[model samples]
Target: MERNPWSLGWIVLMCLFVTNRARELKVEQVGPDNEAVYNHTLATTLVEYASAVYISDMTELFSWTCSRCDGLTEGFEIIELIFDVEHCLQAYVGVATNLNAIVIAFRGTQEHSIQNWIQDLYWKQLDINYPGMPDAMVHHGFYSAYHNTTIRPCVLNGIKRAQEIYGDLNIMVTGHSMGGAMASFCGLDLTVNHEAKSVQVVTFGQPRIGNTVFASYYSQLVPNTIRVTNDHDIVPHLPPYYTLFPQKTYHHFPREVWLHNVGLGSLIYPIEKICDGSGEDPSCSRSVTGNSIADHLIYYGVKLGGETWGSCKIVMDQRLAKFGSKDLGGNFVFSKNPASLLQAGSETGSISI
Candidate 1:
């Protein structure tokens, strides 16, 4: 069978288009300090724990009482759970006894519905700068959600408490989608302000959080940042990264692990591509059509968000029955003095940023 000349020409033109795009993108390789390697086991494990944070009962999470958290929290000790009423943000800090590390997981906007988050991304609301980084301009809403929310103080309190109790262990910060954006902010906060020793940030399906300047400054601040995006995951494409207008467009920080299917026909094979240090590598997920919202829900066969995992409201089983209201969540002891985390203050973990 002879192929049509028109079809062959079209294929050649498409190839040229792809090749030109790749050449235009800045695909820089990170230095040894960046620690941008992908760890399959770790990524899978962390996402599960991140999903477990969706447990609505703050008390259950603090006590490590939720059955949903059982698989993820086997050796993890829940320290604090913050459900910010005003902004509707949920996050929790816990100590992984096995790893001897402090894990901070932020629950994404899935509570409100993923569509709302995606629709909000269509706006071009850029903020001025990220604290000390004067040139780093970020998304206004993401910056405020992290810096201005009640979740900030509560998270800090939790980290401080963990430090006081267990000493300065490693900090692993992670989340999915909107949670991922917050995770990046939290990692930066721990790095500059808190004087945290070791901080690692891994986010899944995270949107472009800031402008080009902000992405650079964030890389310098928190070098150990990994962004995982699935093929056709639309969130990463939002606020739109324009090659010609990068300074004005929203950009992501390196490095990104793109999960894509390379299978032919019905074979259905998937691969994890650890992209170049440039967060906007054109050859990676940026090469595909990012229009599938369905691709945003799963990473490494781990289904995240939606009605399937939303039934933890009752929180039945052994731990809940064991505590039974007598033991309230006193895990994180907040200090009145903003500087102090070791010395106990009021039970209320609220502070202005």
Candidate 2:
């Protein structure tokens, strides 16, 4: 076969361009302990759930948790959207139609009770607030694969799918933990591509992705995305969540993560130097309490179902399954009670930011 040199060169350049543009890890840093400003800063990470919590808000965003509604087919409504860009994995998706907007939900890790497996992996090898924590976590085999890589494609595919359905409608991307990260990436892409007039992101217990530069770029590129995190959710404090594409990073862990493990220590432990300092910085010290991961894990139970840890996991799993199921809008049928999920917050689901 004869090959043209010019064409080959062009192909190679295109390949390089696409590869570079694709979601890959980059690192950067921002300012010091500035929680007020830091709450809004953007960051990314591979191991931690940092990416999950980063999100933006919108004017039309609304929520109406309902056991039943008239327009909705089901008594409860939890819509998710999944896409397979290259037909990689048969992605699952569901969309809930609210008053005037749409809630873009993303799926996450499956349910498991393998603390021992996690412990055997050597808790010390992983980053934890205390030395024995990694060990303890491993003993419980409570590990998660909700990393940056797992979610990037899911989000990319969703953006394309959402634009296709409600191209002109406003979007509010939301998720908890890993799902939150996917939502963040998806919302950012929507803004960049001009798919919607506005994009609002609301997440809980999300970790970081990319790095400081990525966060800055993300914030500059899409200012409307607002990330909401609990005072301290452990899952949101993983190490990879702390460093990415290089930018200033923030850690949201409760004091217990620190108090419980003297040897383990937290990734943000260093911030105490400034956050805990006297005068105006005391607030920074207080902000560093709690564990984002724990908060994330427990949030499902508090917001979705159950009152116990195991029940929380079950509720979260069911909710994620709700999002991951391909049959919701396709094969599945809904009842009126579930219709409330569609009508909950915000009527138009449109934000022009």
Candidate 3:
């Protein structure tokens, strides 16, 4: 039987159409509706608390005695120091008496110096739905980091404890790098499970957490989130988003505040940009290739992964552990040496994969 050329072409065209629809990218972009206004002081302040979470000794962290937290955590009383020895994850749950808010700060990747969590954006699998968004699939590593270990339960217990002590005070969640990803999960968890009233999340050098569905879901559920990415900070651009491969791609939530420097010559101006609410704004940090690890370490002149050579040192004064309460309040302060990314800048690992 002779086959008509026109009939053959029609079959091929139909195959292409079916394949395209099968892999129809589940991404949706809405006009920029940025409601989360960037706060300079608050951003600067939260990064300090985020940095302080890198402390090894529980006593130092619980006492609010870390230098990074000095002057900033003055009114904050630590309620719980969450650490999962197995997963190597650490976080702190505390109450800021002065601010009348509860704080949750998660520790990022622990490296002595020159921390590089986003050398490459690679993922083999992606299957996880956040609290309220079933269609939204998130990054596997981030999902495992936040959900697969005891860290989640510990954090929950800490939040529950804080609420019991402080009443339904506003919750503030902050972290840097990988910790920021975990903070995103915690914020959503609090909203869905704990029935948290007001949740504010601020993160530094945070990477993309989920796909478009997850991003949109997160933006709607946790509306007051500020993701701060510094100039050339490579972490936020990963796990890379591929327009053609939406199912395996990772995406960020809305309201990214990018910090970069604009200069003509001797005089320079530092600029902090509020990205479009669409979550992937080309005019924002995405404008650059995102290839700097040094930018990931410091946000507003503060080193995020500080002195982790001996991080989360389990030092216990048994007496204090047993008799310890706010009733026996005291602080043992330690000094910190921070590298500035603006005025006198320091550089770290600078390779992009």
Candidate 4:
């Protein structure tokens, strides 16, 4: 074995060549083209809506300010974005004549607030701290239970205090990510309980909760709720499975009223029926299911410019057990343009997983 040093050198060179080729192959497997992460383009498209809502809320808040009005006040409320410790939630608040009470509660979950918090704190660039770094950190339900529980009550209490003092004044609820979810829940509660028909909610990237029964209950309970989910925004499609099925009911709005398809219906069926079979390998199957769901939520929203009311409406008709439908795209929201990505998905693969 020690006879030829030249032979040993040849063997080492051959090993190095093989290792280099293997490395290249692995890179290809995880590269952008093969294992790429699809982002939502809806944010940009829906910025106008976001800005409009923000401005409208601001206008109303400003109108509420009365320097001499006994309980009225005006100032920037510092929101400590808990998800990203660096930034704080800053809002232009016009407190109506309620010096001794809390009015107009602003609530949200983690994804909404955290992202805003990070942006506020300018810490989003530091997404390198984790293993998957930014992408590996799954942001399905941005804020965990701790954040949700803590924030929701504070917001409710603030609203209660304000309502008590202001008597007939209005309550405006809003949030970006998880904050949006918190706002939605609070709005749902207020509307359901008959606290106020004036409860206005404007949320971005909001998640789904409860079951169809809950959805229906809220629809009846809170009609003024306006949730704007950007095309393919994944965070909005949460509360994945309906636990109490047979007894529980489901509710879907008119096609022209929904914000996005949400991918919940389409992706769930395929993932559960096909990819998640016994014959498939565990890892591959899981990836297909997870990615498909993620793709449905995020990419679909992104593609549709934060508008899915029409698509969702169509999906609802097909998905509902008893509801009979006449046409698929009859209530379609946007103009059927060939250049639109949403249309492209429908023709080829659909925005579902």
Candidate 5:
């Protein structure tokens, strides 16, 4: 076999690129005092607000507010949009005055479309640059699809309206599952592109968004991010940390507030841990069981009258059926076919994962 000099040089360049990028991965552990920063009352309230927007009719949400938290009815605004071909995406943006802060919450996955789940697997460079920040990359499909819809403009409009009424209050972006992933992106966008200050993102069962580079950039850019995960929620383990493809690498953000014994009533005491900021922290969800969809469904608690109960599971079930079976676990089934796995590893030039 004849070896081409040009091909050898190209291989060397690619190896150097991977090496340099690998050096950039760093996870910083936070202090236990950081747990004090997370307010259960506020998180529960925001989760309720985020869950409410999942209703098909905004009036139902309004009625619930009138019945439960009458104060929310005064300064609450809801914006919903369906984008992408076949209108597969159903995203809602809720701007409300809560906890003395302006909350902008995004609704999570409502309908189960193979197309939408595939979007979760699409990873690429965000290609947008921020001042004093590295070039951030993200799930290309989610980022593009979100901007394609009216969600962006609607959120901007909502923020503007909130400021007009609330006068420079703190802004919080939150959601659950897929909505949480979007919330992370939206929060970063608000701070980087729109110059919105004091933006805090608190998400539930959010999957890994981007590779190490994107995660690092996001952690640095949006330092006040809090990602909440239930004991065995499977959504947070998605896009698999160990994969044959490099571009497909997915990582979670830092400042994780993990809820163990989620449905165990008063016995459930949420543990707040500062993740290594690296997406593949062994101490986090990735190390635990990766197939607990039921855990993802219930955040705070499951029962109707249970303390810290949030209707996310009930609301999500009403939106889509076959909740437990629609698993992303198949994405990692390559081990069953060693020949195909070997081929993929060879093509990618590096199979470190």
Candidate 6:
């Protein structure tokens, strides 16, 4: 039988199409069943508390001890403050006795120094040993600042003290912006290196920490990490995923809990998406428009009403009012209205990612 050239071509095309479709249908299943599972009520409460802690750390006028501190949820009391002069990192370890959880909240960029921003710019390599796991390399600056400074020791000591007093409570590590990055590092370190059990990390508006390998390693070690990104947040897109320089390649973790706005006013809900756990998901924040800072500031604000709203903004507004607009070493500038702080900054502040 003579095969018709056109018929043969059609057959070949059909085969190719079928193969491609099968590949597409082969979904890349990543992580466990409960990997990216998020509890709306729990996440809202935790993030709100974390944001409040950040605001408290940023503004000295509103002490952490203040009962009416904005976003200061009841039950969680600050036990210790961790500070690193060289790294310019500050965090507080708080205890929620009723919940049996210890919250380690990191302070985001503040008015004192641009060290956090400077750390973001350092994308070099610094390898570390991970026992019973793959050898991992992280952001050089982040690792150095985290390792060299007393931050880690202070945190570990705080956790130890808490464990001694409370007896094996859950450790919840959290932060916003630069603090988020540090939170990620601490979460991974504590889980993999220190063998700290039941460590849950929830970061807000955090930037990418390391390369693909580091992300995968961190994801496997700390599966419960939930990165919360607001709509069009500029910080999450930082340190460029696809840079001309080879060493500059960075990736995010697998789980992302995105807070999407329903309408104009404070109505928002979280939608959880699980990537391949490889950190290179184009569908995540890496592909979004990198122009909005409003999203970062309003993480736990009233407009997005829930347990988390209005507290962070209240503290921020108070701080800004107390200290007028100056180069607070952070990116965004403060205005009369805390919400306006997000809208006031030049988009150039965000490095091209």
Best model per lDDT: 1
lDDT of 6 by residue, 209-242 (tens): 7766677778777887778787787777776566
Better of 4 and 6 by lDDT: 6
**Candidate 5 lDDT tens digits, 182-276:** 78888888888888867878888887777667777787778777787877776777766655655435666686766663222233324443355
* Pairs in steric clash, model 5: 27-276, 126-137
Using lDDT as the measure, what is the rank order of every candidate, best first? 1, 3, 6, 5, 2, 4
lDDT of 1 by residue, 1-353 (tens): 99887676667656644643443211122345655556666676688777777666544455555555666457577676666655667787878876568899997774455776688788766766777787778887877888887778879988888888888888989988888899999999988998886888888889888988888888878887789898999988887888898787888889888888663334444566778777889989899988988888877766666453322232223323222222133222212222222323344343221
Candidate 3 local lDDT, 75-137, one digit each (tens): 567766665655567787778766667888988876433343444355434566665577888
- Please give the CA lDDT of all the candidate structures: 0.72, 0.34, 0.71, 0.32, 0.55, 0.58
Show pairs that collide, candidate 1: none
Worst 10 residues of 6 by lDDT: 333-342
Task: Write down the TM-score of every candidate.
Answer: 0.77, 0.42, 0.77, 0.35, 0.63, 0.65
**How badly does each model clash, as a count of residue pairs?**
0, 103, 2, 30, 2, 5
Q: Which residue pairs collide, candidate 3?
A: 56-312, 56-313
Error of 3 at 350 (Å): 37
Using lDDT as the yardstick, the better of models 3 and 5 is 3
The whole-model C-alpha lDDT of candidate 2 against the native structure comes to 0.34
Residue-wise C-alpha lDDT for candidate 4, range 42-106, written one tens digit per residue:
12222222222122122122232222112212332211111111112212222323222123333
